[model samples]
Target: MNAIVIGAGVVGLAVARALAMAGHDTFILDGEPAFGTWTSARNSEVIHAGIYYPQGSLKARLCVVGKEMLYAYCATRDVPHSNCKKLIFAADASQSPKLDGILASALGAGVTDLVRLSANEVRKIEPALRCEEALLSPSTGIIDSHAFMMALLADAEAHGAQLVCNTKVTRVVRKNGQWAIYVDGSAEVAATADIVINSGGLAAQNIAANTEGLDPATVPPLYLARGVYFSYSSVLPFHHLIYPIPEQGGLGTHLTLDLAGRSRFGPDVEWISEIDYRVDPSRHAKFVAGARQIWADIDPTKLRPAFAGIRPKLSGPGEPAADFAVLGPADHGSPGLVCLFGIESPGLTASLAIADLVLHKVATD
Candidate 1:
């Protein structure tokens, strides 16, 4: 079978690889000049331990399973990654109850290695961290997202998958039990395939809307949540990732370090109307305040505005968080087609698992 996977983000690349491995002639399409340029490139790149998400949700299930698969793949593929672990802590006594709730949720999601740490235990592990209590997630880690995506593309190409860049799919239609994809770029191009998978990330809903024969009501509303990262100039004293209790619509402004031990704080949720990558310098004060909650000695002068990324969210302001939507023929009655929506946060960690699920959905049909 011939298959087409739209959107060349990490998830789309992984899906294309899975399809090619399943004996399908797969074509990976992206509008960007290079792969992983959008949502895939702009993320925390943290491997979640299936925490924070509700049990039985796609985010919880996939993140837990995918983290193991990702670590294994990185090791065998020589992708640079670190199992640096993470500490989700309660900065104050009042937040301790919420930390308990988080621990319960993580345990229910089958994350068995979480260790609850007392104040002294937390200090022993991270001397610079100030927290009443913390939960240590041994499975949570970080990866070089660029290298990871490159490895996935290499493997997909090795399995006979073709990646087309600088091309946008203007329209999709179903005819004669196959999919017709219309592309517009330097030249007008048309391609037919046996299956179509829309993993468009930020543009998923638009792709679904343009897909003929699909129900419009089945497509959920898309909201863009802009998150900005502020790089810290000085070396951080802590080694592991430090997170405060999650706030509404985000995991709070936490600290994450790159492979070179440079720490950065960010991702305060800001609802945006359109796609914008510019980072606002005014948010530096807020970041400083947020960072001071966890680390008492954070230098305000060292905080500099870094790049930002927009999350394709399903829920808007004041709404509850949404689960990852992997709509298939079963949901839309469209044979050999799958639409992915609201794949943010753990989407990176769950890329491989999401690919497997997409392949299974198409194969069983």
Candidate 2:
């Protein structure tokens, strides 16, 4: 049987690897000249410890499972990653009570390793931290995202899956118990198998809209949420990743480190109509204020503008966040087709588990 995985981001690449390992001939399609250049390449490359996701959601489940798989793969592939741990602090003295709730929620979600710490304890772990209270998550860490993606691509290629960069999936058509994916304008790759996994990420809605005979009304809206990051150019005050109490809407700007141990802060969320990578230096003052809650000694002069990434958020602000939508033959009534939407934040950490999910969805159907 033959299959095609759309979108060459972390999730797509992971899916391709899983399908290839399952003895299926697969092709990876991406419009960009390079893979993982979109959301996969941007943001803090933190391996979440399943702290923020709600109970019983895919994010919570996959993050915990994927983190284990990711660490295992990194070890086998010699990929660089660190379990440096993280501290989610309540900078506001008034937010101390909320921190208690955060810990309870995290624990309820199966992150039992998260424990509370006093301000003095926090400063001991992070000598320069200025929080009144915190939650130490030993499972939270950072990874070399590029290395991880390369490893996935290599594994997929080794398993006989092909990656065709600069190749766009223009449409989907069904014929004779098979699905044919149109590329550019002239060529088409037919999946003789009865499964099509759309790991299209941001472009998933458009791909679903183009799916043969899918109800246009059933296609949910895709919201664009832009996040920006900045790097600390000088001496780092802390050894571990530092985060603020995350709101239900977004993970607040937090200090995170790369594999080289350099510190950077980011990912303040902004909703936009289009995909924009602009990092507004004007927001430095706001970041300085927020960041100071964790590191009182953060040198404003040492901060430099960094890259930005936009999430394909399925829900908007003031509304409840949407769960990871992995649509399959059961939901769409179209055999051999699966669509994934609203895959953000924990998407990287959950890449491997999400692959398993899509793999099972295809196999069980």
Which stretch of 10 consecutive residues in model 1 shows the poorest summed lDDT? 181-190
Query: How well does each candidate superpose onto the true structure, as a TM-score?
Result: 0.98, 0.96
In model 1, residue pairs whose N, Cα or C atoms come closer than 3 Å (at least 3 residues apart or on different chains), thus clashing, are: none
Tell me the RMSD of model 1 versus the true structure.
1.3
Candidates' C-alpha lDDT? 0.92, 0.86
Query: How high is the lDDT of residue 30 in model 1?
Result: 92
Deviation from native of the Cα of residue 259 in model 2, angstroms:
0.9
Relative to the true structure, candidate 1 reaches a TM of 0.98
Clashes, model 1:
0
Off by over 4 Å in 1: 185-189
lDDT, candidate 1, 197-270, per-residue tens: 99999999999998999999899999999989999999989999999899876788999988888889988779
